[model samples]
Target chain A: MTAAPTRLACFGGIYSNYLALEAALADVRRRGVDAVYCLGDLGAFGPHPDRVFPLLADHDVVCVQGNYDDSVGNELDDCQCGYVDPQDNHFAQISYDYTLAHTSAEHRAYLRQLPAEIRLEIDSRRVLLCHGSPRRTNEFVWESTASDHFLERLCREADADVVLATHTGIKWQRQLAEGRQFVNVGVLGRPENDGRRNVWYTLVEFGGDQVQVEFVPVEYDFARLAREMADEGLPAEFQETIRTGWWTTCLEILPVKERRRGAF
Target chain B: MAATLPVIDDPRVPQVELASFDQLWFQVAGTLCNLTCHHCFISCSPKNDSFGFLSLDEVQQRLAESVPLGVNEYYFTGGEPFLNPQMVEILIATLEYGPATVLTNATVLKDEWLQRLADADAASRFSLEFRVSIDGFSPETNDPIRGEGTFARALRGIVKLVEYDFLPIITAARSWPEADEARVVGEFTEMLRREGYRRPRLKILPMLHLGAEVERTHGYRPSERITAEMMKGFDRSQLICDHARIVTDRGVCVCPILIEAPDAVLGQSLAEADRPFGLSHGACYTCYQYGAICSNPSAASGGGHAARPT
Candidate 1:
């Protein structure tokens, strides 16, 4: 196994948000990070799906295959976001259709070839990176719902000292037994429904005894993106979420505590 | 639907091995309920004591046992979870362990209990969810199935839950036809909003053909049984028996739906209960048809509607 970089920048689910991706990449470059990684979901819920590919390629962002990536790459019927509600699914379908139609064939091929998971040894600490939980590609590992022991078991089963994932869109970190850690590296595609118009990424640094995890918020041209979405005929709900940082669609999949924290 | 079946080993019966102890359920109220709904799958009523209430000490014991086993979330159900005297305490204690969800009819909820529960949930890192049962959008449609005035009472309880900043998920059995789903859900959402619930969460359940429901409507036919052929390429994780085990006063049962069956009681402890369950019950068919029927829609155990790749 190759030794991973000591300082790494990680983001999850670009969701076709090239503007945010640009800003996040610039911020990480300024921070002098050794490596930058993206945990899949390269497309969905945003306009101009093709715009994100060049930025990722230029920045040398390593990728993992998200459920959306799996669907769009394979030309599947729906984005397997794991939403059971009809309204949520309806909006998800709209996003998926728009994304799949707009994504370039070459980009789709790239997504298809992306690994489902990326493993590296960071300072001899086994680190695993995936779009969702290591067990399932589409699983929603929400903070309030995922118990400590459950996460510990997942870490033990995956044989990783640190597991980084971000399918649920929200960012949370939990310390497990024996100093193991599980972190959801938030999402760059949209705001985290915290009534703030800034999306976030995570910086994981391992050199000392403790593993340092920092959530770095990226302020970008969200108004321009929303206007672009309107021009592209994306749902007003999606734009509203981008502008207000409050999720308007796909609300049912959120666990009770998470939903209660949101304006919707 | 055929009167309860005996636990006989059949070669055709497909057995589902426990995948992970993700969900730990407690039959907190047992079969005793304040109101007797016509379509109750377990036939719970005021006089029905086939099952008994689980005390706080019993629930705490199981919660402790669940930690090492890596139980993801906890669910509390029965005729009505609030019917149990220690329901509030049980939930508060459970919050220390993990996220807790309780299924209730909402007619017997007290403000004091809601206040205390809300405070406990606020302090804990886990979520405390309430799934209120209301059969219809209006009393005219709902009263016939659930007792009279229950629709109004349930609405009031929902409003109280909202006042406590709790987004209660209104779970209604699909008493109406599939065609009317959109209309019924819309009306239900509107009704709750008018009653002071701004953002209403709703979960519609397919009526299980068992217990009181079997008498009200019809039982499962022989054709409804799941065959070994049906298990081919099927996602067994969708079935509750593959991930969940319920702790009843009698013992740890296979799943919540089949507690009435003597064979449902698998063992006394979580360790002993961790075994493959035979999907022989007719209700298992409903579970097979619609996975995660008993779990909250947002729960990890709840099956997604999207078509997963085989």
Candidate 2:
């Protein structure tokens, strides 16, 4: 058992957005967090998949494997994005094929070696970090869908006082029974479909028995990323999300409340 | 033409125990619907009072009881959930506990009801999902099965839902051949886009060969029964009975699809309903083929789809 730090920076689903990752890493360093972590999904929906690896390695960001990482690392055919709609699947397939083709073999090997989950003690408060939920690597714990009691059960099953996950690309936190907490750290890959041209990361600070969770928004060179995506021959829909904050693809999986908040 | 229930007492039938109470379904409007669709699995009709409406009080009671069990989501169904006058209130109340999804025919929806639901959903942290059933893409194709003028009426209801900012999932049972799936889905998307739904969500469902559907098509064959051998290495979570239970006016049922069967009623409460169910019914075969058919797309898993999301 290693000693846990009081403050940490965490993010997930980079989606190969190296510009955002660079900005986020610099921001994390400026905040003076004791350590940094990433919740897998290091590639997809962006250009230059190889650009993200050195940023993570230089920062010593410990990572947990996401479903996308699992798929790309193993050379799987699709992204395993769990979309049911035909149009959504069509776009996802395009992104997955591009990401898989562009990802370097060395980076693929690194993704394959990443652990599915990481456990640590933050001031004696057990914190479990995983790409999605602790139970399933690809589960979407959307803020509008996950219940307090359900989160409590997940904590109990994982034997953690705090659970941090990403994968839904949205950030939310809920304090559960016995002061336990579950946090979905927003992604750094793209905007959260909120019509804002910025991505987000999460900061967790431990004080005695209290765990504080904060979502930190990061602004980067979006126009450049959009240009890169277009140059890579990615779908216009993917670049549209980077240029504009609204998500153009993968709209069906969103719950109604979350979908209502978006501009479509 | 009523559908006949099959009785199978073979011990070889696979028994699936409750994995977790993730989804709690309410047969809120009971077996009474505004339209008598030809392929309705439960044969719901305007006068089919075989199952009775569940009041807001009953739903509230179940919601309270379901909290401690760690239920993840809630669903409301019936002949048509909106037919129950308190359907909006029930959905609002459910949002307080967990995410709620309602399955409806869309013809009975009113603007006022959607307004209230939209307001409630905005305030709550949980989502309120609507699954609107429209049999086909156009009136010529859909009216004969659902009812005359039902296609146009349902489209109006869907447009209203969109106006209220509800991304209602258009659910349709696959009446056309499988080879035409792409064409049918494409047409449905085009029609919805023309009707002001810029980002239409569609779910194609397999026909459950029971109830009114038995009269239209045929019931499941005897070989469709799931044997104990079939359960080997299978992901049991794909089965609704493995993770869900439905509360009706009478009591808790095993699953939403088998409510008319006498053996489907498990108990009076969620606690008592936490038991294993035999996969012996013919409709169970449809569930076996098409996993999580009654659940919203958000919770469904496995069945000729891409892998789970990243």
Name the top lDDT candidate: 1
Steric overlap count per candidate: 1, 1
Per-residue error for A63 in candidate 1, Å, reads: 0.4
Off by over 4 Å in 1: B6-8, B300-310
Whole-model alpha-carbon lDDT for candidate 2 = 0.87
* Candidate 2: segments with Cα more than 4 A from true spot: B1-3, B302-310
Which 10-residue span in candidate 2 chain B carries the lowest summed lDDT?
B301-310
Q: What would the per-residue lDDT of candidate 2 be over residues B205-243, giving only the tens digit for each residue?
A: 888888988889888888888887787766676789988
Docking class of 2: acceptable
The weakest ten consecutive residues by lDDT in model 1 chain B span B301-310
lDDT of 2 at A190: 93
* lDDT for residue B103 in candidate 1, whole number 0-100: 93
